[model samples]
Target: MATKKRKKISQAFTKSQLVKEISERCDLNKNQVTHVLDEMKDIIASHLKKNGPEKFTLPGILKIQVRNVDAKPSREGINPFTKEPTVYPAKAASRKVRVTPLKQLKEMA
Candidate 1:
């Protein structure tokens, strides 16, 4: 049997990537983009919990927000590798994301 090689993606895309492109076009550094991303992540999480999923749009780049989700009880399954079945009884909340494609970005690709 042959094994397929894995490709590694950087934690943050290269300086020439889309996100970095936006950062540069907006006159911000890559680190600034990372900082904004981190802060926005926490803000979205809090908004989802407190006020429910609220839609936040970034105009042209991307829209970030949360949507209301239900917690569901699920069944357990066995780990094929170990052959041990484990049940998780706790209910889990489902989170989802929606990305609005932009015309410029679509053309860029």
Candidate 2:
């Protein structure tokens, strides 16, 4: 058995390049590929929205979850570098998206 050698990509693929590659491999037109990508964006957005499920999973690729973070009050903390007391501003509570790559995606890396 022989394995194929793939080129090492130095940088991330641009959207155009990604669309082209997906279109080629999937035997779909570029326009269709673009539309599918756009739809996926909408699906993810709606699933992760405030009133939605707060979780979106692309099976075999990754899982996306929303996490609620609590607000932090302003406090004095010691600066490690300067060895001085400094006041850190309070941070507002917010929701954050957490994306975790699954087994298949991790294996690809």
Give the winner by lDDT. Answer: 2
Top-TM-score structure, candidate number: 2
Per residue, candidate 1 scores C-alpha lDDT tens digits across 35-108 of 88789778766755646556666556666655547897777989788899977676778766666666666675
* Model 1: CA > 4 A from native: 1-53, 94-101
lDDT of 1 at 46: 70
Q: What is the TM-score of candidate 2?
A: 0.81
The CA lDDT at 65 in model 2 is 100
Q: What is the lDDT of candidate 2?
A: 0.93
| lDDT to native, each model | 0.67, 0.93
Candidate 2 residue pairs in backbone clash: none
lDDT of 2 by residue, 19-92 (tens): 98777777789999999999999999999999999999999999999999999999999999999999999999
